[model samples]
Every structure is written in structure tokens, then in C-alpha cells.
Target: MGNKTALYDKHQEMGAKLVDFGGWDMPIHYGSQVDEHHKVRQEAGMFDVSHMTVVDVTGTDAKEYLRYLLANDVAKLQQKGKAMYSGMLNEDAGVIDDLIVYLMTEPGVAGEWFRVVVNCATREKDLRWMSDQTASFDDVALTEQPDLAMVAVQGPKALELAKQSVSESRATLIDQLSVFQGLESEGWFIARTGYTGEDGLEIMLPEDEVADFWQALADAGVSPCGLGARDTLRLEAGMNLYGADMDETVSPLAANMGWTIAWEPQERIFIGREALQAKKEAGISEKLVGLVMESRGVLRAHQKVVVSGVGEGEITSGTFSPTLGCAIAMARVPSATADQAEVDIRGKLVPVRVIRPSFVRNGKKVFD
Candidate 1:
């Protein structure tokens, strides 16, 4: 037996195929993974994301503490509810984890608060690392919000359909939120964010109310999606998976996350600054890129990529893109590699085109 979310029974009731995901028994699919994937792309689908860890950082020194903890500068968040994606790094410029931090209070305000959502698999290590770092800061406090359950409603009609499940007041708030922004109403926090590269809301509310809320969404015509579809959707969107694309051993720069680093205000000084600065000076030897297999056969992780005259690399994440009707992958290869490469599948060398990692956005293909 594994840990189960508040909606575990609901998933089983819907005939979901349950599997162990990072110690949690999660739904892989209700029936057909492809159908669930298409439902999100064509209409609305909801996913139980309560397995993700949510932590609240509060107190007078909260802002200062986060500025030192994340590679991205939280000082750039000028408004409350604004969210920023960042990479928490180690002293050696290696990625500890990638997360989203929401500024919960107004800028330059006392009693400042911030909400951080981290990968469930890295929850223990991340909490320990955060605790050790905050030991020296007496004014800041960290509290894990285990009482909250999160649900992601996504796709073209996600916002409209999700609104039917909440109150009219909450619906209005959800309609007004901009991309990457969030707002709290009636004890529920709704954010205009999603993993599917589609317009959606990730709502966090009291755990006890989640089952009823999920049932309401289902009644409102929102399809119940599972982890299998979630993986394919995020892969098509070119989002990095925690353990597959990068880990404690890999730097953000090599994981296509260099853009997440805030280099200005040189004095802000966050963890891994020294090592990142040194890497910048020395020049990065490898980088993450997108691979398109127009040829037959599927792409899978750990597949060897040969860049003609350049050195070899490996596929970090790969899948058959439902939207593109082809296989796509993200790979770490020699920085000098050009637009062409060959993926070693089994014993055969298959030609592939290298491009930017993002293959789709807003339900449309972004690559040529």
C-alpha cells in the first residue's frame, strides 16, 4: 500500500488504473491514456495534484530568506499573487529542484508571506534543506500545509468548465486572474497555472472538501485525467521532469533552465551563484535541446544521440506527441551540435532533427 490523496476513492470509483508514483498510489488513467490526453487538448480535464507538497513561508524576513534560497529573484514580483518559476540549487550550481513560488503579500510589506510548491518526490530532502538554511534566520518561519488538496483543471474549456464547480464569486476571481497569477477567495486559492501548456486553474482548498469538489467537476462535464496523460501532456509542452531531466548532479544551465536564473543586482547572492558564475565564464559544454523523430519508431529516455562530429548525448525525456502525431524528445547534447543528429535506437542509428525544446503551446504546434 502507498500514500493516497484525498481523491483516491473518487479515482477508483471512476475506474482509474492506480499505480505507485513517488510513494503515492495515483491514477495512471481511467481507461485509455490517449483518450484522456485528447480530452485535455480538445476540451477540459481535471487532475488531482494533491501529491505535490505546499509550504508556506512567513514572517518579517521571508522575502530576504527566499531571495537567498532561489536562483530567480523574488524581488521582481511587484504584486501580490504573482508567481515565478525558479530553480533551487546547491552550492555547486547543481539543481536541487525546480519549483514555483507565489508572492502571497504585497511588496515591501511587513509580515511578508510566500507559498512554495515543490515536487513530491523531493519533498523530504527539500524540506530538510530549507530548514537548515533557515536556521540562521530567526524572523522567518516555514510551515507545510498538509491540510490542503490541489486540483488542476486544464485545456481550452478548462476555465469555463471549472467555474461551474465553484461559487459565482470564486468564478469571477478565476476569470480575472492573469497568466501566472493567483488569488485566494473563500479559503480557496486558485492559480492561473497548469502543467499541460493550456489555460487552466490549479485550485488548492481544504482537503476534506476535495472529493465533493472533484465530483462536482465530473458532473460539470470535466473529464477525470490521470498521471499517464499528465506525463504525455507535460512532455509535449517541454517541461522538465524532476529526476529524469535533472537532479542534484545536473546544473540548471545544462537542463535548459539557464533562463530561470536572475543574474542582475549582483549583490542578491543566492546559493550556487559562485559555481554558476564560474560556469558562465568557462562557457557551458552541453545544453538541452528538442528532438523531432519524423521517422518511424518511438523515442525513449536514455537513448544515445550522436551529433555527427560532435560528442554523444542522451535523451532525458521522450514521448509520442499526441498533438504533433510524431515522437518528440528533450536531450542533453554538446553545445556545438547543430540542427541534425542521430538517435541510437536498439542497434540502429536513426536521424533526428534538433530544435528548441518546446513542441507545442496553447494546443498548437510551435515547431516547424
Candidate 2:
């Protein structure tokens, strides 16, 4: 009896194994999650990401408001359709959420708009925070776009085959999209973005038109994947899982997300700036890094990690990497941790290798 997306029926029709995700009944997998994972790496796959919250921001003060709201500077977005990834923080410098914001319109355009996509589970608090911050800006407005449904088409042939599923003109538009840019056409927002660590597009269109589009992609030979594959794929790509890797209690500095924080210009005071500055001055004691247990067993979240004498840490997200054919994990460990560590697996302390936080990219091992 959880909330359902507009594509819920379609997922059921395709024999998806539905599970509760962020209060929504979502497909965990259609069949054989490992097989589906390989499909996306080898060819193309489509996922129903309609449950993600999309909010549109506009008005005269929109730009200024965003600059103050996110840790990253939006002033760097020079042109329309460009997108940036950022984290919203509380006054204490804890990560509220990680999101992507797209500059919807350029300067002097009719409507200076920005679109933000946040996690489905954190929508309520995220919206509340966004609106509360807007109270200082009289002209700013936030519009929740529940009428839109999103689908992420991904893999090596993702763009090429997905283009054939849409109109010829839309196909041409897709070809023009760069890595992180997005554009609107015929009421649909097509963005060159994805979570699978592969080249792909996330298309937001009217909910009514989504079923037809999804079916067309299936006709074009794109496989229908589910959350199980999605999680493993993103993990292989070294992307952080919200609740597992970070939450309201964790700072971005400890979550391997320090790169997302923009600390320049000194004057741009966003929420959590003061606290994050103090933390930077104090030094980060722990860090998020990649763990490789290539021997036999799989690594999982909540497993205790021992860094010999430094201290203990815990795995945030871990699994058997289908692409790498080995077990990999992201763990928060003592900053002093180096090449070797041990993970407590089933009361047995198993040795592991510590490396950079990424494992695979473009179907190959990336970490040294």
C-alpha cells in the first residue's frame, strides 16, 4: 500500500518485482538482477525514475536564491541548459541532500528558471527547506512538477537507440546535447544525464505520454531494468547512496563529496558555510574510500572495518560488482588508513585493500 508512480502499472505488466522504496512501490528487478546489470553495460536499458521529485524555480531572485541555497556556485553556469551537481546543507554543515540543478533559462529570457531534482524519500523536507529559504527572496517561487514522469535510458547504445524511439526532430535534439546539458522541446525536458556511469539521457515528459514512449524504447530493443541493477551500477560508478553513504548527520566532507562543495570567492555565504569553514580549518579526521575484497566474499553496508591501529570504520555501501567480477565497497574510514585494512565479515576479520573511491568506469577497472 505504498505510493506508486505513474508507471507502476507498466512495471507490473512487465512482471517487475515491486518493493517499497522511499514509500513508493518500485521495481527492484524484472528478472535476474545480475543479467539486467550486464544488459546495461553491454547494450541499453531504461529505468522508471518518475518517483524522483522535480521542482521548478523561477522569478527575479531565482539565481541569487540558488547561489545562497546550494554549496556549489550557480554563477558558474554561463549559459542556459547547463547543469550542475550540488548539495544542500543545514546550518550545522550536515548534508541535507545531494541534487542536480539545471539552469532553465539564460539571462534576459522571459522566465529565469532553474530545475532541481532531489531524492524521492527526502522530498517533503527538501521542499520545506527550499520554500523556507525562499521567504527571504520575495520574487522567488517554487513549483512542484508532479505531472511529469522521468525515464533514464542508459548504456553504450543508449543515446543512439533512444534517439530512434522519439521523433526525428527530438532525435536531432538529442544528438546536440553535451554531457551535462539539458533542453526543452515540445514540453519535454531531455537531459544528457544518468546514474549508471554510462552515457545516457534522462527524459522528463508529460506523465500521459510516458507509457507510449517507454513502449517505443522497448520496441527499439532497450531492456527494462529495475532498482537492483540501478544500485549495483551506481555503486560500480562510485556514486554515493543517500541514506547509506550520507544523511542529515554526516557532512559532505566525510562522504567523499568534498569536491561538490564550492569554497571560493570567500563572500558567497550559503547555508552551512560557517560550520563547513570551521571544519576545514579543524581538519577532517575520517574519509570515504573504496574497499576491494577480491578474494571470495561480498562486502556489505554496516560491516565494521579495522584499520589496524588507527581506528575502526564502517562500510557504507558494498556489493559484488557485476562489471568487475569482484566485491567492492565504499567505506568511511580513518584518514590515516592506507593500502591495507580488514573487514569484520561473519565474525571473521577478512583482509581487504584500500584504494580510491571508484571501482569501474566504461566497463573497466578504474582504481589503482
Candidate 3:
């Protein structure tokens, strides 16, 4: 038996195929994964994301502590409700975990508060690292919100559906929030952010209320999707998978996550900044890129990628793209490679065209 989310029973009730994901028994799909994928891209879908860890960092030194912990500058988020995406790094400049931090404001709460959301698989390690860092700092506190159950309502109708599901007080606050901003009401926190490439709200409510909320969304015509569709949807959006696209072994730059790194505010150097600076100056040898199998056969992870006249690399994340009607993959290859590459599929080298990313968006194909 594995750890289960608060919505575990709800998933089983919907006839979901349960799979073990990072020690958690999660739903892979309810019926057809392909259909679920289509539902999100074209209409509406909801996912139980309670497995993700949400932590609140408080006290006077909260902002300063996070500035030293994350690679991106937390100072940029000066306004209340502002959010920033950054990566926590190890001493070696490798990515520890990618996360989102929101600057919050409560009705009588003075000083600044931060809410951080981290990957479910790396929650323990992340919490440990955070604890170690905060032990020496006075007036800083970290509290894990285990009582919260997160649900992501996504697609073209996501916002509209969310307005109907959330409490009136939270609905108004969330309605005023921009992308990446979040609002907290009673025990529920609603964030206008999501992993899926669509307009959506990630609502965090009491675990006890999860089942009723999911059912309400279903009754409102939002399809209940599972991890299978979430994976395909995020892949099509050019988003990186934690363990696949990056881990403790790879730096953000090498994984095509350079945009997430904050290079300015040179005086505010965080962990791995020196190493990242050195890499930037030395010039990158290999880089992450997108590949589409030109021939027939699905691409998969760890497949050998041989670039003609360049060099070799490996596919980090790959899948049979439902929208593209073909195989698409994200691979780290020699930076010298220009137009094409080949992937080793079953002892046979299959040609693949190298493109940028964002293969699918808004229910349509964006790239070949």
C-alpha cells in the first residue's frame, strides 16, 4: 500500500486506474487517457493535486531567508499576492527542486508571509533543507499545510467553472488575482496558476471538503482527469518533468530552464550562483532541445539521440503526442546540432526533426 491523497476514494469511485506515483497511489486515468487529454485541451477538466506539498513560511525574516534559498530573486515579488517561480539548488549548482512562492497578505497579519508549493516526490527533502536553513535564523517559521487538498480546474472554461465552485469570498478575491497570484479565504486558498497550458485555478481547501468540491465540479460538466492526462498536457505545453527533465544531477541551464534563473541583483548571490555564473561564462557544451520522430515509432526516455555531424545525447522526456498524432520528445543534445537528429528506437536509428518547443497550445498544434 502507498500513501493516498485525500481524493483517493473519490478517484476510485469514479473508476480511476490507480498507479503508484512517487510512493503515492494516484489515479492514472478514469477511462481513456486520450479522451481525458482531449477534454482538457478543448473543454474543461479537473485534477486532484493534493499530493503536492504546500508550506507557509512566516516571520520577519521569511523574505530574506527565501532570497538565500532560491536561485531566483524573491525580492522581485514586492507586492502582496505576487508569485514567482524559482528553483532551489544544491551546492553544485544542480536543481534541487522547482517551486512557486507567493507573497501573501492576511487581514490582521503584519509583516510578509510566503506560501511555497513543491513537488510531491521531493517534499521530504525540500522540507528538511528548509528546516536546516531556518534553524539558525531567528523569527522565521515553516509550517506544512497537510490539512489542505488541492484541485486544479483547467481549460477554456476553467475560470468560469472555478467561480462557481469556490466560496463567494474566495471567488471574489481569486477573481481579482492575476496570473501567478493567490488569495486565501478561511481555510481555502485559490491560486490563478496551473501546470497545464490553459487558464485555470488551483484551489486548496480542507481535506474533508475535497470530495464534495470534486463532485460539484463534475456536476458542473468538468471532466475528471488523472495523472496520465496531466503528463500529456504538460508535455505538450513544453513544461519540464521533475525527475525526467531535471534532477539533482542537472543544472537549470542544462535543462533549458535558464529563464527561471535570476542573474541580476549580483550582490544577492544565492546558492549555486557562482557555479552557474562560471558555466555561463565558459559557454554551454550541451543543451536541452525538442525532437519529433520523423518516421513511425514512439519516442521514449533514455533513447540515444545521435545528431548527424554533431554529437550524441539522450531523450529526457518523450511521449506519443495525442494532439500532434505523432511522437514528441525533449532531449539534451550537443548544442552544435542545428536542424536534425536521430533517435535509437529498438536498435534502429530513427530520424527526428529538432524544433524548439510548445508543440501544442489552446487545443491546436503550434509546431510541426
Candidate 4:
């Protein structure tokens, strides 16, 4: 048996097909992945993201330390309850992990603090790295929130459904939350964020209470989705997967995550900044591109990508997009010939059209 989240029993009751994902027994699907994908796009659905790791950083130097540790500038988040997405990089500017850090409105005494959520697969490595980086700092204390479980409610009506599951006092906070904002109330840490290309919320509550909260949302008509739908949904939304899209050997610029890097504030310095800046100045030879298959075949990872007259590339993440009704992929292709590449489907090399990602957003198709 693998590790189980707080909603393990609930998932079993719902007839979910559970699979081991990064040591955690997670639901791959309930019944139909395509139907679940469409549900999140058209109505509302919830995902058990409890396998993710939550860490809290507190101290006088928390913000200062983070500013130097993360590739993105934490100074950009000035308001309380605000969150920022950033990448932690190695000395080579290669991505270690992409995470969301929340600037808590109130610290322990009710002022404010910083909290981060990292990918489950990189939990141990992330903790060790974070600890090592902050070890020299006298003012910071990093603590993991192992007592919590995360549930992401997504879709057009996701916010409404999530708000209904919370108490009146906590529910009011949702009304004032801006995008990329979060807050802590009672034992719940609710954030106005999601991977689906729809406005929604991700709530972290006490592990024991997770099933109850999920039941409440389900009673309100929110479908419980699984990892299969989550992957396709996030891919369609142009989000990157840590392992599939990027790893320690892949830099942000090469993974189409250059936007997450902040090069401003000439006075501030962060780890891997020099390497990244140098890479930018030298120009990246390969880049992540989006692909739409013109033929009848599903794109899979590691598929060969051949440019008509150029070089080659490889599909990093691919799937049959339920929303687009076709196969879509994110590939790492030679920058010299990435515009229009061909994918090897079956034994034949099929032509594929390349475009910037974000294939679907706000329940609308963004790509042709």
C-alpha cells in the first residue's frame, strides 16, 4: 500500500481508480476522465491535492531570505494575503521546483507571514534544500504543515461552490480575495488559485476534516475529479508539470517558464540569476513549444519531433485535449526550427502545427 491522503476512503467509496503517484495513492479517475475534464470546464469539480507539501517560513528575515532563494522577486508582493509563483533553481539556473508562496496576512501573533506549497514528488528534496538555504539565517523558522490536506475546486462555478463549503466568517474572505491571494482562518488556509484555466480556489484544511468538506462540496454538485483529468486540464491551460515538462537539468527559459523569472531590482541577487542572465544573453538553443496534431493520433511523451527542413525535438507533455477535441502537446524543440514541427505518430511522421500554448481558458478555446 502506498501513502494515502485524508480522502482515501471517500475516493474508494466513489469508485475512483486509485494509482500510486509519487508515493501517494491518488485517484487517477472516478469513471470517465474526459467527462471529468468537461465537468471542470463547464461546471465544478474538486481535486485532492493533499499529496502536495505545505511549508511555512517565519522570521524577521523570511522575506529577505526568500527574495534571494526564489527566482521570482518576492518583493513584488506587497499586499497581505498575496501569493507569488516562483521557481527554485540550482546554481546552473536549472529548475528544481516550481511553487506558490503565500504572504500570510498575520504571522503567529496576527501580523502576516510566508507559506509555500511544493510538489509532492519533490517533497524531501525541497525540504532539504529549503532548510539548507535558510540555515544561516537567524530570524527564520521553516515548518511543514503535515496536518493539512489540500482540495482544489475548479471551473466557472468553482468559487461559488467552495465558498458554500466554508463557514460564514471564512466565506466572506473569498469575496475580497484577488487572484494569487490567500488567507488563513481557523485551521483552513484558502487560496484564490487553481491550475484549470478557470477562476477557482484551493483550500488547505485539517486532514481529518477534509472528507467532510469534500462531502459538502459534492452535495452542492461539485464533481470529484482525479489526476488524469487534472493533468489534461493543466496541460490544456498551458501549465508545466515538474517532472514531465522540467527537471533539474532543464532551465526555466528552456521550459517556457521564463516569465516566472524576475530580472529587475539590479541591487538584489538570487541564486542561479547569473546563470540565467548569461543564458538569456547567449540565447537559448532549444525552447518549449505547443503542438496541435493535424492527424488522428494522441500525442505522448518522448515522441520524436522533426521539423520539415530544420532539426528535431521531443514531446515533453502530451494528451488528447477533451476541450479542444484533438491531440495537443508541449514539446522541447530546437529554437531554430520550432515554428512548425512534425510529430511521429505510429510509424508515420505526421505534420503538426505549432502555436503558443494556453489552448483553453475561461471555458473558451484559445487555439484553432
Provide the lowest-lDDT 10-residue window in model 1.
103-112
lDDT string for model 2 (1-368, tens) is: 99888888889999999999999999999988999999899999999999999999899988889989999988888788899989899999999999999998885466788999999989999999999999899799999999899999999999999999999889989999999999998889999998988889999999999999999999999999999999999999999989899988888999988998889978888999999989988999889999999799999999999999899999999999998888999999999999899999999999999998888776777877
lDDT of 3 by residue, 1-368 (tens): 99888899999999999999888999999999999988898888999999999999999888889888899887888667778889999888898899999888742247778999999999999999989888767889999998899999989888887778767887688679898878778878888888878878888899999899999899888999999999989888888889999999998988888998888887886888898988889998888888887567899999999988888999999999887788999999988988798999989988999888567877787774
Specify the highest-TM-score model's number.
Answer: 1
**Candidate 1 lDDT for residue 215:** 94
Q: What are the lDDT figures for the candidates, one per model?
A: 0.94, 0.92, 0.87, 0.90
Which parts of model 1 have CA positions greater than 4 angstroms off?
none
Alpha carbon deviation, residue 204, candidate 2 (Å): 0.4
Predicted structure with the largest lDDT when compared to the true one: 1
Tell me the deviation in Å of residue 31 in model 1.
Answer: 0.7
Worst 10 residues of 4 by lDDT: 104-113
Off by over 4 Å in 2: 107-110
True lDDT of residue 49, candidate 3? 91
For TM-score, candidate 1 versus 3, the one ahead is: 1
Ranking by lDDT: 1, 2, 4, 3
The local lDDT score (0 to 100) that residue 335 gets in candidate 2 is: 90
On residues 40-144, what C-alpha lDDT tens digit does candidate 4 reach at each position?
999999999999999998888888889889999888888787888899998999999999998885433443468999999999999999999997677888999
| Candidate 2 residue pairs in clash (backbone atoms < 3 Å) | none
> lDDT of candidate 3 vs native?
0.87
